[model samples]
Target: MLTDLPIRKIIHIDMDAFYASVEQMDNPDLKGKPIAVGGGGKRGVISAASYEARKFGVKSAMSGNLAAKLCPDLIFVKTNFDRYIEISKKIRKIFFDYTDLVEPLSLDEAYLDVTKNKKGNPSASKIAEEIRARILNEIGLTASAGISINKFIAKVASDYNKPNGQKTVNPEEVIAFLEQLDIRKFYGVGKVTAEKMYQKGIFTGLDLKQKSIDYLDKHFGKSGHYYYHVVRGIHNSEVKPNRIRKSLAAERTFSENLSSEVFMLEKLEQIANEVSRRLNKSKVAGKTVTLKIKYSDFTLQTRSKTLPYFISDRNILLETAKDLLFQETLNNSVRLLGISISNLNIELSKKSEQKSVSVQLKFEF
Candidate 1:
């Protein structure tokens, strides 16, 4: 249990509407206006929405048409991933300066272990405040931070005060803070899980705490144990720095559902090229290729193939994607097509080194 273990100071930092905020910051005309950063077409889904647009019920993943209807004056901007990546690198540099124990969740969010930081600062709250301030001054954008004894509480606390704010949860207050929290607000408790908890009469942290671990496991499967520990403030996941990249992918939803084999082939070629670009940008290659297909009716299908050698060339990726697409029969008109490469070579050298070290140790013994 977390109470029995030495507490580690953790902080979860999340940017404020990252992509949309970057658009607003670069274009003064977009500032203080309802804007969405995404494709603006019949089939386009919003990637991010500014707080102003959110006021009128706009949200990420909503259809562009629906978002436009919600806020008639809403403006749409195409995604600029290069700019977002540049800014993300800057933010991550700030995190590394403070602690090497940083785990990035996305381009806009990360968990940091600051139990012992480079600055030798004792207060996590002060560190969070300084980090947030640095982002605003250096990057011209706002961020929110949550400071607590562990990652779970820190992640949740970050949302309590958003858009240039910070919150701290002390060790002594962890239990009380958790008990009063709504089940829906708990990390890993999505809408479906919350409904299941509601059906079982578990509405809050205190209610979840009442269930025996056996009962929870019996009802909720493996996640049951997770809930049991989390309700008691027992999350102990570490913040791992320089985590390996598992895969690189590119996907797109069509403006119109496509059924023609020729059209599907063309789209696959484009998506494979995108995957190749991302792989090259990351300086990685992969041995496994997966193709994802989503039908207009929402049914999904996936096909994958593992190659004998790692590859990153655009032609090879496209050809492999083509083979996978043709191998599967068309079940329905496709609405979305995606290509991804996994089993990346990024960590292969490290694995080889570890194996060599183990062999050396065994020989010495």
Candidate 2:
């Protein structure tokens, strides 16, 4: 379907081990060493791991004890979100120089529609290269990029070469590149979906292409149509700027599980205060409150209530969370507690629709 001569040029930019890399860039001692951020205690979980640590099976979300076991020399550093945010702003400013059509997915990654960039560059790949160069020279950090016909393929290609590298999946090569792609490599297919697809004999993009839209829909539900089109190189999602957060949440994973609801109440208050602080910082308020509960056995549960009006005051958030906590009986000892506010006022603000443009191919990598 992407064969329609005229197509949009998209680029996916991803920073490399951002938090850990920043720590290393600031501290010479951390460079070239196995280091992890935010896993300093006996029960602590890693937020990010340096590439050196990654070689020893260390990774984000892994337990500190396990990481220490994997790499005895692994050093743990506390998270500095303020510093990360400062640096992220600088990176985003760099993006605005090349294009106003930038969509930041997180602090460390973004998508750019450079078909009509401020730089007036015809080759999206060149823009990506120059952007990566600026990030390294100006920010003292390395970044990788994927340039292609759409967000999905570009996102997939971005991972092909990582840590100070770039990949460009030109228009003509989109089909065969996607056909030979591993099902696990599809942008939206997570581990669970990949395994489910694998069980159904959908191992590669080509295999997925073999199934008719009906068969895919019968097996995969709503995502079936999504897969059918993407495998044929047909993702058309546009890069949206000023992306707003749908929900704001604060969660705490305890060093030890609490056996009583009374103990959780105190923790819930702390989480609610954090949620409120974040809400005020973002200048947003929500009408829906949700409480997340994670059991020691790894099972998870959520409870929510919609209010008559939006509220972001710490006391109100605490009260709403307290109500949700008691709405249901506890299933097991709780290891994690989270409070979130949703249906925010900012979501009500509308963004202008992006106009689609099609023209004969006029650029090359």
Candidate 3:
């Protein structure tokens, strides 16, 4: 089916050891050193480990103690969520400059559909090269990119060249590439499935292609249809953007209950700033700004204001939030301060005005 339709241009971009790379970028001494971004204490899980650490058998999702055993000199650092979020925003902005259709798998990986790009460049490989260069120059980090005719191939291509590299898979070469690929390399075919496939003599794409759709369906259920087409270099998935805000929330549990307006305003500023950042990152502007307060007596109250236009500006958001906080009477010591922005506007385009005019006979009047 992919061969029957016009070829599309898709790209997958993944940062190299995202959190560990960020740590290295911030500290020059950590370069070429085995580093992990996570707590080194007991009961800590590794968030990310540098390539150097990987050579010693350290990996993300592994327990920190296990990583330490693998790499005796592994350096573990505390996670800085704010800093990581900031860098993620910058990387996402670069993707948007090239194409509006970007699907972020996480903070470090994304799928971009460049079939109709903002740059109007027909060559997807060239666009990927430019994007990779821009990210390295601006973010002080390296990323790997894959360019292909569809999402499945593009995702596979990105991993082909890891740690600051790029790879392209043209439509014509897709079949040859798939034929030689090991079954384990296929998306959704993990270790368990790979073992099962191996037992069935389905070790490669060619082996998978030989199997009937019904046979695969009997084994894999709905995903069998996906395997049936992908082995033949066919994939129809589209890049989807983050169009809605799943939750709009901001909260601060203070160390001490405070009745002072000054202290409460300061806390509200921080909450509003966080909400604004999240709204902007998701490309959503909110019409309602909600203020929440929890008193020392365990009583909770909330007030919300809906504005004429959606807003994401920090100053306007904070100012409105502070005003709402002051409007409510402080009956007890406040133990918490919160703000949330909701009712997202996904579309960026302005609405066009519709006008109607009628002219009467002035002479008759």
lDDT (0 to 1) per candidate: 0.88, 0.90, 0.84
174-202: candidate 3 lDDT, tens digit per residue: 78889899888898898899998998999
Best by lDDT: 2
Which run of 10 residues does model 2 get worst, by summed lDDT?
354-363
Query: What overall lDDT, based on C-alpha atoms, would model 3 receive against the true structure?
Result: 0.84
Candidate 3 residues lying further than 4 Å off, grouped into runs, are 243-365
Question: Over the stretch 29-97, how does candidate 1's per-residue lDDT look in tens digits?
Answer: 999999999949789899999999999999998989999999999999999999999999999999999
How does residue 174 of candidate 2 score in lDDT? 83
For residue 326, model 3's alpha carbon misses the true position, in angstroms, by 42
How far is 292's C-alpha from truth in model 2 (Å)?
Answer: 0.5
In model 2, which regions exceed 4 Å deviation?
A: 4-6, 347-362
User: Per-prediction TM-score, please?
Assistant: 0.89, 0.95, 0.67
Span of ten consecutive residues with least summed lDDT in model 1:
356-365
Backbone-clash count (model 2): 0
Number of backbone collisions per candidate: 0, 0, 0
Q: After best superposition, candidate 1 residue 135: deviation in angstroms?
A: 1.7
* Clash total of candidate 3: 0
